[model samples]
Target: MAAVTWSRARCWCPSLLQVFRLPVAKLYLGRPTMRASQQDFENAMNQVKLLKKDPGNEVKLRLYALYKQATEGPCNMPKPGVFDFVNKAKWDAWNALGSLPKETARQNYVDLVSSLSSSSEASSQGKRGADEKAQESKGILVTSEDGITKITFNRPTKKNAITFQMYQDIILALKNASTDNTVIAVFTGTGDYYCSGNDLTNFTSATGGIEEAASKGAVVLREFVNSFIDFPKPLVAVVNGPAVGISVTLLGLFDAVYASDRATFHTPFSHLGQSPEACSSYTFPKMMGSAKAAEMLLFGKKLTAREAWAQGLVTEVFPESTFETEVWTRLKTYAKLPPNAMRISKELIRKNEKEKLHAVNAEECTTLQAQWLSEECINAIMSFVSRKPKL
Candidate 1:
């Protein structure tokens, strides 16, 4: 009789509670193993249900969700205070806690806990879609306006450097926009900077690994760029200042490129001890001729927007005051055209560029993923993060 009772308890107990040996152990208020005071747990669950109507706070949901995961029993478990909860667990030791026996229920609880925590944290961010929508419509925005979307790189505070989550947001936004016919043309950057380039601060946490920080940005950045280049609608770029690193190369692929006379461009490939990105190696030369393109890529020369225009890279240079209105008028003109007409013509021009961009992005991801995990990249990032200005 004693052996049979012990075996039943072993099969029923949750791993978190199995360590406890009855009498002295503390008990949580919510659990499946109870009878006389089970209504307490039911009351707690009911309270949680009421809170659901006001999910604006979300605290109750988070607590209930955690409790549900911590226990391996029917969600309609009993509530026991610390002393009484322990007594209930010991009392119900011989009974299976959930419908799927015990082990299966425990596994579900563990998995549910992990997922709910992550999701609840993400939810705390609150209506991310709405934030993006507001950004797209206001201040200065990047747009093909219809079927083509734009993500303006704002934040001159950090020299227009992008944050890591910002990178992820752009990627996800572009992906979401890709499916919508309302988006076709995509542009980037705003204010006085085209992009002071990737916010170097995010390099350390890059998903591909560490040593390859530069490569990861170049690789991830290329994906962000190609969404537009290969887009069925024309991609336009309006530059105002240094189009550094990835920014410098991406512009070469734009269907239309405009810059302010104050706009400048450079690629710090050599400064970072990295190689060139995109097919900037191939397309830059093809677009601007070998001699001129090499001058910019090889030297990382800081070319003024007017200089880039002269070299056949930029389409035109506009004054700062009029640049926004001029680009908007141009883009909206295209947006108003028969959508299919614009897409078909765009397809013909980008067909070959699409193939090249694909191959480059794959190779780039591999090369950069390796570099992100390297020591030099680690120190470079840490130093940059810690450094105060050398007065």
Candidate 2:
């Protein structure tokens, strides 16, 4: 059998689980590479179905897309029309794979299920931690009105730097908006700056030893980026001022990105002695071409709003005085449209990248977590914190 045929056969067969200890990938030359155990994949799939709360539309579509792609190879059906929201979303998600082979899709499915299962279990064990409560007072401010959900980074005194709890809050807010049928779009912004990536103080102050803190911090950040990857609704970012670190990378995931005339964006991963986050490794190159992505990630080039717009990284730029009003007006226009239609359209646009993004996120997190423990990262953080003024 051809490699694709064999992979599809194994994916569809349950009895094969009894014979093989794990899923196997056959090389073009006929050698088998060990992958996840069949039992492991099945268990992850089952856990997904058993989870109490819905994983929201994007995740549901992702699961369906991955399952179909793994079992049936690339989509062979005709694309659905625009008005057929349900089938269109499903079709687009599956068809986005184009001609992706079966084994790769299976591996992607396995990775997604494992991540979701872990997240669900963690939620079930706790309602909300102290960190969440501590930050509830002022970190992330969420307000919804007239179909618009606005999530603002409110820690301006600290240049809108995000803490672990703030990350969790933002993820929850986004997930909540995804389920709220009335919520047509989500707008993220900040007072003086978009965000300063993360608060290094929070990371260093984490309890236990340095290694434990780094590991736990990496886990939290991974969950945050994964949530962004699966955000279902139209995410719109209003870059009111400067954005740094993950904040800059995350703009690639937004469906619409508007910026103030004074807005600036930069990712200091290379300068910080850390790897990229938020799957920017893939999304950036796709959005701005490989040459530009290399400059941003490798050289830490900062771009003004106009520069970003010219480079196709931003949708538009407006004066600081009118930026919020203009962005809200645009969001309201989208909110007035058919919610299902809007969601399906966004999904279709993002569907092709779904699996590849998850894979990249997994790889990035592993490397990032290791980097977090490195002497270079430790010294960098120490110097930044002890310096006269923060970076």
User: Which predicted model would earn the best TM-score?
Assistant: 2
Taking all chains together, each candidate's TM-score versus the true structure is 0.57, 0.69
Model 2 deviation from the true structure expressed as Cα RMSD, one decimal place: 9.9
Assess the local accuracy of residue 75 in candidate 2 as a C-alpha lDDT between 0 and 100: 82
Q: Write the per-residue lDDT of candidate 1 for residues 1-391, one digit (tens) a residue.
A: 0112323322332322332323211112123342323343334433333221222111222233334433544445454456654334433332222233333333333332332333444644543553465356422243434444666777765656666556666655555444345534555565557787656666656565554556556656666655545444456776766678777787777778878777788876544445566667767888889888877777667788888888878899888779778877776676676654555466546654665776776676565555555666555556656772211
lDDT of each: 0.54, 0.70
After superposition, which runs of candidate 2 have C-alpha atoms over 4 Å from their true positions? 1-137, 388-390
Off by over 4 Å in 1: 1-148, 181-188, 205-209, 212-222, 370-391
* Residue-level lDDT tens digits of model 2 in 1-391: 1122233323433221112111111111111243656566677676665545444544555666767776788788888686755566567667666666666666666775665554555864433442244336478877667787778888888888888778778777766666555545464555678888888887689778778877887778777887777776678887888988988888887887888998888887876778888888888887889999998998989999998998888999999888779878877887787665666566667666777877888888899889988888888888788882544
| Cα TM-score of candidate 1 | 0.57
